[model samples]
Target: MAHWNFSLLFGSAVLWAMLIPCRAFPTGAPASACENMLPVHTGVQPQPTRAPYEFLLSSPSFLNGQPINIQILGPAYKGLLLEARSFGSNAALGIWKTPPNNTKFLQCSGNPHGAVTHSNTNLKTRQTTYTWLPPNSGCPPVVMFIATVAQSREIYWTNVKSKVIWKNPKATCGAQMLTRTWPAAALLSSMLLILLVYL
Candidate 1:
């Protein structure tokens, strides 16, 4: 009976010794497992939260040589800085002649919609407008803009995306290309699914 007890105790000690390393190494959590299997998440940081100060624009797309207005019509954002930028073919509207002061216009052509106050509370409603005069004709029929917000105290830059809808309204610019949605939708859905799985 004494020999049998010693053998059982030795076995228990070995089992615990093996488990101790797993618990102490901290390498088996789901996150660690994912990190081991996948590349590091590398991309731009997320835009700050707009909360009540949402972007309002005239159209969802833009056309060459056409004038479009961008309105920041919403509540004030506390502890936040707003920035507007144009990318793709229509990028010229904002970054063309002269880029706005980085400190002031948020890189837009003219004035920024707002300088929201950051707070634990909700954002205030505010409004501003930016008119984009499209470049010469034959530019991409559709472009995009990124309106970003920076958290005052932190290094977080939150952004809201706007589709610079291009249209000749009068159809004088030539045959226009219709915007497609399937590709964007598919990409977004896939990302959401991955996020859900991780969560």
Candidate 2:
């Protein structure tokens, strides 16, 4: 009888342990996530299938020092991290506006507000928004938005990406892709129009 009781107790403990979640990031993503852009849920791989969420950019183009709003839409998720990078470079670019309720900013690679991540792990939310402020002058002509979304500890997606967003015709590309977003750009357009009319 004594042996049976001990066996039952041990089984119960194991069951309880299995029930508990492995929440490494109970508050938010760790600082280590900055470089890898990956969550700390070690041993678990991001889902190979397509992510259910999508990034909706408020505008197709953005201006220097100007902000563009990006929203994640789709199935409910537990945590997420978002970053913006120049089209070709792996480096994250731009800062973010203050994080909204239940969200926080993650600084990556010396860039303040370089990234944004979830503040609450229990909140299974379907949507979130972020406002990105691109570099004032020197930045790529096009920006790419990437993210990691976790539906649960074991279920998540990495390398989530959005379509390339263009820099406003009024804002010059700092590097990567150079463009003349100055008064001369407008003057050149006017010149082209006049040339077309004459021809």
Most lDDT-accurate candidate: 2
* Candidate 1, 36-111: lDDT as tens digits: 1211112323434443445577766555554566555544432233322334321223222222222222222332
Compared with the true structure, model 1 gives a TM-score of: 0.37
Give one digit per residue, the lDDT tens place, for model 2 in 1-199.
9999999999999987865544458677877887677887756888999999888898898888678989888888878888898755667788899987788988786876888888887664545668888887577778889999888878989988988988777886465555766698889999999999999
Residue-level lDDT for 27 in candidate 1? 13
Candidate 1 all-Cα RMSD = 21.5
Q: Local error of candidate 2 at 50, Å?
A: 0.7
lDDT of 1: 0.41
Model 2 lDDT vs. the true structure?
A: 0.81
Task: Quote the lDDT for 88 in model 1.
Answer: 34
Against the true structure, whose TM-score is highest? Answer: 2
